[model samples]
Target: MTTPNELRLLPWSGSGDKPCYLSTDDPDGYMSRLADSIEAIQLGTASELLEEASEALDSQGTSLDDMRCLVKELTGALRDVYRVAASRGHLLTTSDPREPTY
Candidate 1:
């Protein structure tokens, strides 16, 4: 787990023109970009959860020990969503101006 201080590190660390521009854009467009980034982070987080669950099942036999069928089902679904959303958001971050180029 990331400590609070570790997680407090800002995703954007520099002060510059790109940061200023992203901060000041058409309201609707800015909102859309914000939504996109939020979705991307959510998807990445869900994917990490799925990976953790799969590892637990494979290594610890939680599937048989706990009889928690929902874990298996949810892990699969989350992994699928993670795959699609992460890919789209990653490409967008790389190619779009919504994120500052560093």
Candidate 2:
């Protein structure tokens, strides 16, 4: 199974295809487009995992420890993705009026 953090581009490998270059040609716009793509996949996978966890928990009944742990793990996976993205500056922050923390 592929880990959430790994980048997979099938049919392409290093040194063959021209690499994706994030240049000063249009930094913010380039980063914004990258961020949008990241958000789409990250949010999509997170949503699916959360839904699966919810169904698993419901089927297993309340007070199930394993289900709770699974939910936490899934949540952590998502948090880590966002944290790394922000650290890499793919996400921008403003301090004026402040936005939703999440």
Candidate 3:
């Protein structure tokens, strides 16, 4: 069994909007692969949304409703990206050989 520190933070949430985790020794396991694939998709969507946001901002004709919709999508993408970053950061820290000085 893996320790709490070794648990992988899943990309999606659970009931009551709680964060989900996967505890596995195999990084190439089914769940791990699924999470990796989903993360990739999430990142790609965020990248495309960023480009769209830039274009929308550049266009003077972008309406308030359009901007609102874009903002909503950006917010969800940002949340996913943040979760991915945090999970990766934790993994790196736990796998590092050097101990923190502070």
User: Candidate 1: misplaced stretches above 4 Å?
Assistant: 1-28, 61-102
lDDT-better candidate, 1 vs 3: 3
Q: Which residue pairs collide, candidate 1?
A: none
Which ten residues in a row are the worst by lDDT in model 1?
4-13
For all candidates in order, the CA lDDT equals: 0.50, 0.53, 0.93
In model 2, where is the ten-residue run with the lowest total lDDT?
A: 4-13
lDDT of 1 by residue, 2-93 (tens): 23322211122246612111332343565446655655675676667667666876775565644466466666556546545444554455
Task: Please tell me which predicted candidate would have the highest lDDT against the true structure.
Answer: 3
In the range 13-68, model 3's lDDT, one tens digit per residue, is 99998999999989999999999999999999999999999999999999999999
lDDT of 2 by residue, 1-102 (tens): 223332222211237653232333343565546745765676677778888777886784645687777879797667746544553553233233356655
lDDT for model 3 comes to 0.93
RMSD of each: 14.2, 10.6, 3.4
Return the lDDT, model 3, position 76: 99
